[model samples]
Target chain A: MSTSERLIESTRELLWERGYVGTSPKAILERAGAGQGSMYHHFRGKPDLALAAIRRTADEMWATAEAVLDGPGTPYERITAYLRREREALRGCPVGRLTMDPDVIADDALRAPVDETLDRLREHIAQIVEEGKEQGEFAPGLDGEEIAAAVVATVQGGYVLARAAGSPTAFDAAVRGLLALLAPPTR
Target chain B: MSTSERLIESTRELLWERGYVGTSPKAILERAGAGQGSMYHHFRGKPDLALAAIRRTADEMWATAEAVLDGPGTPYERITAYLRREREALRGCPVGRLTMDPDVIADDALRAPVDETLDRLREHIAQIVEEGKEQGEFAPGLDGEEIAAAVVATVQGGYVLARAAGSPTAFDAAVRGLLALLAPPTR
Candidate 1:
């Protein structure tokens, strides 16, 4: 890979592991095995590099979700697939983790992709939920937007529980509970 | 407050705002308005001081939740109360945010209260769910532990959404969605 590509990938890893405030340009250089001149030559500074990394992470997350959400299945079934998809629960969500960094959240430019990624994902889930509601899959009173919000929150919160307990059991249990709630009323 | 109290309080605030890795010894001392000698005089170092602060935060979070869970209300009512409680949603949960801090979670001593706080809260909520189940408030098939886990994850994850959007709309919507799911089976 080129020097710029190496720098972006290294920044993504550091940002995921240490957060924006904790990640330094020197560490990025060391991890990327690229010199300072290379980083500045390709990108303006740390913030500029970080934005690219974050957008890349956000885009990849969307692609992963899209593959499941838009793939073959009923709306509810697809949501289940999204939840049950294999993940490193302990490692946490790459894009979601960035939301916790004050430095990232405080800057509009840094935060845009992170915000848009979540908003778009939730909206996509909401659209599927709307389809389910129209098809009488979920109960009538449930709001598509609200239900989708819960679905997204469960995934994000599950990571927090998994990390705190050093296990995926809590995350699994939470997802199980959510799927149970979303079960078709024919039961 | 004593010098130790000031230091602990300052550390708690710093941990909440900046996270463990971002919080420095100098910043903690400055925030506490205490001298370097005062910090060393009371605790071994940053880790020791952070533990005390974390425990304190954990205890307070428990106390707040217990007030509603243990209050005079039906099980479902109590859960709703817990969900609807006033909060600075965009600032995020103090203990929950710490779980995202690698420096904190990696250190068993530092992570104990954070893990315990979430575990204990979920367990406590699970007990309430059990009571509601026994009272015939919820559906017969639901599991208390799993349901409680979802409830807890909603709050933790809600903060992520709120922070990402720089608004409380998503968090409020998430809690509202959860309450709808948890509504008594009579509906």
Candidate 2:
């Protein structure tokens, strides 16, 4: 890859590891194997480079979620697909992880992509819930938006539980618990 | 407070603000107004200090949640009270925040309080849900554990949304949406 591409990729990895507050431009340059001039040549500074990385990570997260949500299935099936999709449970969500970084939250340019990604995902899930309700897969009075928000929260919070224990068991349990709630009453 | 007490309190604040990976020993000492020797005298190092702070934060969080959860009210009323309790929406949960730090996850001692705090909180919530079911406030088939997990996830994810947007509106919306889901249906 070119120096610019490598710089963005390295920033993404470093941001995942150290977060925006902990990561330095020097570290990014070192990780990418580029010098100061080369880094500055391609991007304005750390914030500029970070913004690029954040956007890339945001897009990647959405694409992954879409693969499950938009895949061929019934609404319940799609929701299950999204939850059961293979993930590096210990590593946590890249976009959700940024929400914890003070530096990332303090910057509008950096935080926008993170906010938009989650908002879109929640909206997409809400749409699926609405479909489920129409298809009689869920209780007639169930609130689609509320259920969608709850669903997304489960995934995000499940990561926190898993990471804290240094085990994926909590994450799996949280997911299984959610699926149990979503299952039809007769089953 | 004693020098050791002051140091632990300072570490808790800094850890909440910057997380375990982002905080430095120098920063902790400086914030506590304790010199290096004094800090070392109280604790072996940053990890030891962090464990104390995390435990303190966990205790404080549980105390706060119990105020709402253990209050005298209907099951739904108590759960709603817990959800509506005042919080610094942008700052996030102090215990939950640590789960995002790479260093905290890397060390078992540092992570124990966070894991146990969440685990206990989930159980506490599940117990409340179970009571609600027994009281005939919820559908008989509702899975108390699953609903409890979903409720906790909403709070954690709500903080992420609020912080990312630099507004509490999203957090409020998420909570409101979740409460709507938990509300009884008019048959």
Candidate 3:
């Protein structure tokens, strides 16, 4: 990969592991095996680099989510598939973890990608649920937006519980519980 | 406040906002209104003081949760109360945030209170769900443990969503959605 690619990749990993405040330019250089001058030549600074990395993470997150949400299945089946999708529970979530970082959330430029990703994902899920209701797969009165939020919460919060216990068991349980509650299979 | 009390309180605040690696002895001392030597006099070091602060946070968390879980009400009501309980959503969950801190999760000493609190809380919620089942308030087939995990995840993940959007609206919606699904008002 080019110096630019390596830098962005390193920033993503550091940002995930250390967060915005804890990550440093020197650490990024060392991790990416690029010199200080190379960093400046490629990007303005750490914040610029972090934004690039975060966007990449966001793009990747949305890609995976859309694949499932927009996949072939009823709203209930697709939603369940999305939740049960294998995740790195111990690592928490790339986008969700950023919300915990004060530095990331404090800056609008840095936060835009993060916010957009979550907003879009939730909206996409909501649209799917609405489609389900139209198709008579879900109750007519079910609130699509509210259900969307619950589905997103289960996955994000499940990581927290799983990490605390040093296992993915809690995360899996949360998904199962939510699945049982979601319009269960009537087939 | 006593120097020890002041130090513990300051550590708690810093931990909530800054996390373990971001927190420093100097910051803790400055926030607590104590001198450097005073901090050393009260605790062995930053790690020791952090453990104390974490335990205190966990203690307070349990105190609030139990007040409702053990209060005079049905299981569904108590569970709903716990989810709908007012929170500093933008600031995020104090204990849950720690799980995202690499330094805290890396150390068993620092992680104990966090892990214990979440474990006990899930178990407590699970026990309440079991009661709901026995009381004929919920379907007997519901998995108490899974439901408890979902409840905890909704709160933790809800905070993530709220912070991401810079609004508590997402968090509130998630709770409302979960409530509508959980043992509906069938009197």
Question: Ranking under lDDT, best-scoring first?
Answer: 1, 3, 2
- Candidate lDDT values, in order: 0.92, 0.85, 0.91
lDDT of 3 at A109: 93
TM-score of chain B of each: 0.97, 0.97, 0.97
Query: Candidate 3, residues A38-123: lDDT per residue as tens digits?
Result: 99998898889999999999999999999988888888889988998989899989988999888888899999998999999999
Model 3 spans with C-alpha error above 4 angstroms: A185-187, B185-187
Across B54-91, the per-residue lDDT of candidate 1 in tens digits comes to: 99999999999989889888899999999999989988
Cα TM-score per model: 0.98, 0.89, 0.98
Better of 2 and 3 by lDDT: 3
Model 2 residue A154 CA deviation in Å: 1.6
Please provide, for model 3 over B1-187, each residue's C-alpha lDDT reduced to its tens digit, 9 standing for 90 to 100: 8999999999999999988878889998888888999999889999999999999999999889989788878999899889988898988999999999988989999999999999999999999999999998988888999999999999999999999999999999999888877855475
Report the C-alpha lDDT of model 2 over A10-112, residue by residue, as the tens digit. Answer: 9999888768877889998889999999988988898999999999999999998988899997898999999989878788888889999988887888899
Instruction: Note the DockQ of each predicted structure.
Output: 0.84, 0.54, 0.86
Error of 3 at A39 (Å): 1.1
